[model samples]
Target: MRIQWIVSIVSNLVSMGLLVIVMGQYQVLNIQKQREEKLKTEVQRLANEYANDDLSKVTMEKLLADGNKTMTELEAAMAKLSPELEKKRKDVDACQAEKVRSFFQFPKIITLTRQCLFSIFYPIHTNMND
Candidate 1:
């Protein structure tokens, strides 16, 4: 009977330790979710400020605007710009290769701005996953 009681106590302690670890993971997950929400908010704000700004103007004119940008607006802008930028780059490269004086240069300012914007959220996710 004494042996059985000791065994039960040890099992309970082990279960408790596992419970604690699971709870710790849950806490971390919750914190990460909050951070993700914050990042999404900021991303939307930036999208409205920089891209698809015409939508913002229309929304303001209607007076029904939430004064915040949606992901759809941002995505639409990216879809339109990505192909156009790629084409421009290809054209410039072709011109340069043929020894032609290409007037086109990739915009470093935009690239740096995008890097700075996304760097805020990406490192947090990378470190958390590790």
Candidate 2:
């Protein structure tokens, strides 16, 4: 009974740890997705506008109304969306910055640590004096 209880407790703890790691990964991936969408939209908008000169005339009119006005509006839009974009950008950058952050960051580390710990218990003992 005691053994079973201890095993259950350890299993539950391990599962919880795994859950946290999974949630973090999901969050990071979601952020990447958001960043991807933002970049895609930006690219498509620019491409379409570039491809069709007059296609963006409506927006251009706003730009032509007053040069500074366009900048101000752009700035405002950027200011609002910039934070959200920046957040996702930061997530992606952090993920890219560290090999571990990309995907399975925590799991890989945990697995490596576990393996190392297990490996230390070899079939034969090494020279303790050495």
Candidate 3:
């Protein structure tokens, strides 16, 4: 009778251990599932935060307005300087034509003067040396 009772108690303790192990595994799985759900919720929350029309539209509008203002200012500056630029351009063209004429004429004058000097001085030099 003593051995039978001891055997029954030992079997009960083993069965209790198995039961605890099973419950612990189930708890772990439940915790993992809960964590996965929380992560999913957080991702959705962040997605909605950016996907909504909260700041994107306002920022784009502000940027476009600023760009338009800048473009208008740039156009105004160009318009104001348009006449001055035109005058400068005409002056540059006249100056360039004058430069071309002077360049071609100066070289011819220099060559002619050199030839005249050589023709006049060679005889003078030869007579003087003799």
Estimate TM-scores for all models: 0.38, 0.36, 0.56
Q: lDDT of all predictions, in order shown?
A: 0.83, 0.86, 0.97
How should the candidates be ordered by lDDT, best one leading? 3, 2, 1
Clashes of 1: 0
Identify the runs in model 3 with alpha carbons over 4 angstroms from their true place: 1-47, 50-52
Query: What is candidate 2's lDDT per residue for 1-103, written digit by digit as tens?
Result: 9999999999999999999999999999999999999999999998887878866776788778799887899999988998899899999888787865546
Off by over 4 Å in 1: 52-130
Q: In model 2, which range of ten residues has the least summed lDDT?
A: 121-130
Q: What RMSD, rounded to one decimal, does every model reach?
A: 37.6, 47.0, 6.5
Clashes of each: 0, 0, 0
Clashing pairs in 2: none
Checking candidate 1 for backbone clashes, the offending pairs are none
Q: After superposition, how far is residue 64 of candidate 1 from its true place, in Å?
A: 31
Query: After superposing candidate 2, which stretches have Cα over 4 Å from the reference?
Result: 52-130
lDDT of 2 at 111: 93
What are the per-residue Cα lDDT tens digits for candidate 3 across 8-125?
Answer: 9999999999999999999999999999999999999999987776688888999999999999999999999999999999999999999999998998999999999999999999
